[model samples]
Target: MSVRMLSRFRAITHYMKLPDDYEDSQGLQFRKEDLNQREVNQIFGGAHLPAPMANKLLRILHGRRVAGTLNDPNLQVNTAQFSASDQRKALAYLRANIPVDEVINAGLRAEDELKLLEREEDGEQKPVETSPQDLPPDTATNEIPIPTGRLPRRRESDSPYGVSPLDRIRAHNIAKREAEEKRLEEERKKREEEEALGNIGTLQTQQEKPKKLSPMMQKMVERATSDLKEPPEMKAWERLLPQAIMTVLIFAGCAAYAIVYTPPKRSERLWPDIPPAAATCLALVGINLTVWVSWRLPPLWALLNRYFIVVAATPRPFQLIGAIFSHQNFSHAMLNMVGLWFFGTRLHDEIGRGNFLAIYFASGALGFMSSLARLVLTDGLIYTTLGASGAVYGVIAAFFWLHRYDEFKLLGYPPDPMSGPQGLAFIGLILGLHILPLFSKKAHNIDIPSHLGGILAGVVGADLVKKHMDERARVRAERLKTMGTLEGVVQVKEKGPEKAPQTAAGR
Candidate 1:
């Protein structure tokens, strides 16, 4: 026999001896001597028979021959004769060796194959024998028959325990290879399913093949994908660069304008003549001393500083500034100081010392100006005002503008006093507290015009501060967005190869 045929024959022989219950068989179904030349030729004719097919054929021969059918040339192969166990084993055997399409084409029934294998393995085949004359005409050559008992035993060296070690190794390797292929196929299918589900649009992958990404391109794609999922955080450079640039530009522009433009002849100093804080303290001290002296001496303040009181008769222009500092009694000074303390600290912190002082004095000046205007327009009357009520009202208005969204409540009557209609109600409530005194039998002096002027100044100041801060925040937000977008673009460019592969895949 050729080497290929010899290998195939050896494989069959090896499988036949694999079952350990060979001794329990009732007897041989057909001895090797029963196979005529024609049957032997049929068994060996197929070249490169897979090991599984060869094993199945061997089992079939043993089964038919032992059933006393060795001489019948006209008997058709009856697949139903194989039991359920035999069919399953046969089909499994075929599946391992061939593609699923070929296994189906081969018409191997797993159920029936398994049954035959099981029955034959149980040593259930009955013995059957025939003389040479009983064989078909072509197979009945009158040669002397060899008895079943005379069959040759496999040599100990030919196989270890009647099975070749080399065949076991080959079978093991084939099984491992098939298992690996199955695993890879399963993984490929799972990946496709996941990709299909992830896509929002119609899946277009049926006709398109995926092009593998090159290493550099793959890294780019990975980075871009990550960026798309999670926005990159703002780095220190991103946060500070715009602010620095803007600040530099502002300073440079201011310096250029200052250099280019000359001012008109000075009417007064640009800054306050005295530091605002120091000026305010001295004014308060002077007022307190005046009150003390007036109470003790009685006639000193009335004669010398009568013009300090803001009234139509003694209304000196300078008294607008001076009257702000003076007080008729301690109670008047104390009340104005309380208002200053409440609004001054916060305005100073928010706008800086320079801006705070500017707002304080500017609001106070505007307040008194409004009062002066009102006094000039009114009919002849004596309306004396000697407190910082108008300037304090300006501070309160600034607080309202800055904290418009803040909640305010009053007397537990209406909640959210600063919102919608409730805000209007609160305004009316405040106006009633201040204005109703004008009609009272003995009304205390209240500077309504100064309060109105202060409110206007405070609103303008708060808006300016808010506008400046908001612009800074807006610029920072824009810078962050631009940096993130640019970073994505840079990463993509660095991974140029990745885009090419993805483009190819899309195509």
Candidate 2:
């Protein structure tokens, strides 16, 4: 496409989208519009109500406060004073009678009333003026009377300042009206803005100034904020069913396939024969590699990040499986794939491919489940886990468990085999490396707990595989023994206690 066409296409896309400020009242049924503590204070102070009505309302508020269904000790619910707790409760319960708009109007009245009272007070405080005509009859004795009382205020015309008192009062009234009009105009604008944006809370929020609260009141207010936090109503078990079901299928399918299907003798091929354990390992490595590579692409990273990592806080059970096959870093992927190739193929060759896959997938799934349990128990759901280290650990641990008795050479065939004790020491060293990092605060990124869970799963998988093999071996031996006895019995019957058959030459 040409640049102009592309730009036009972008504009169309932008216009097609709903604006960011658009909102719907879909949740209006569950939504609440409550008066905050400051709005409730206006009612208590009776700024807008008559003296009798304000007193009655206050008494009613106090009565309702003491009788509320939920009592918080921190709020001092029993106190006679209008405690902060009372204010909180009053705001919550009295929102019906004293809505936010009513409070705002009361504030509007308050400003005007206060301005008039201030003008009157200033008039009273001014020094009284004595007109020359009001002078007492010049004391018969020519001594001017020393004024003992306040004199009358100077008339507007007699005032030393050029401005008349009526003009000043007119200006003050005009200023007061202008301020009131400005307030009304601002509120009108806010209402219009709210209508355009579809936010009903805008008018109240802009009109009311949240009072600076004392520390105790601050704590009480914070405590009340829990009302905003939705309760934990999610059905986690439903979300987790996919992971549990898949893990079970892995183990069950392994058992069923290994026992029920029998490969014909000398039928082995690249097509028919079950691939070596390396096949499963390499397949898994490829999956992880594809995920890792995809993550590097700018267009796909967002998709990978959203779906691949199993975040404990989010209900994304399928991510439990995705996370096992995901790796974002090259070094992490290489190390895990290397470990799998080294140990997994050997383990697979001994155990059938079915059992090998069972160990790998089941271990990784259970490893994440184990980590999930830890996060929930310790309240650490904020952590997100993604990698194949857990599966790799399970493969390594299973290999070690099955070959516990065998001497192993780590470096070269010429090197001395690390016998039983030496092997145990090496395993211990590796385990310690995983376990030690957990105590340090800086090593939070390392998922040592998941590795430990995988190790446990590997040991269990190894034991089960061994028992299955032993049981299959016993059944085969019993069948062979029965066949041998039957063949002998058949030969005797064919002879019929005599020379039933002639020599081969006679025939």
- List TM-scores for all candidates, in order: 0.33, 0.48
Top-lDDT structure, candidate number: 2
- Per-residue C-alpha lDDT of model 1 across residues 1-507, encoded as one tens digit per residue: 556433222211222222322211122222222344444344445333444444544444343332323233433233334444544554454335322332221122232235446755887652232333334455467464322211122232444466477865675466446555766898688778767776322444633546777887676455433122332344434433443354334334433442344323334534356544444445545564565455444334443254455654335555656665556677767777777766666665565444454455556656766665565456323456666766666666676667666555546535553334333344345557766775778844577777777667666766765776588689999999999999999998999987898999999
TM-score, candidate number 1: 0.33
Alpha-carbon runs more than 4 Å astray in model 1 = 1-308, 409-428, 437-444, 472-507
Residue pairs with colliding backbones in model 2 are: 129-152
Q: State the local distance difference test value for candidate 2.
A: 0.61
Tens digits of lDDT, candidate 2, 72-107: 242232233445654554455445543233333334
Off by over 4 Å in 2: 1-275, 298-303, 412-426, 497-507
Best by TM-score: 2
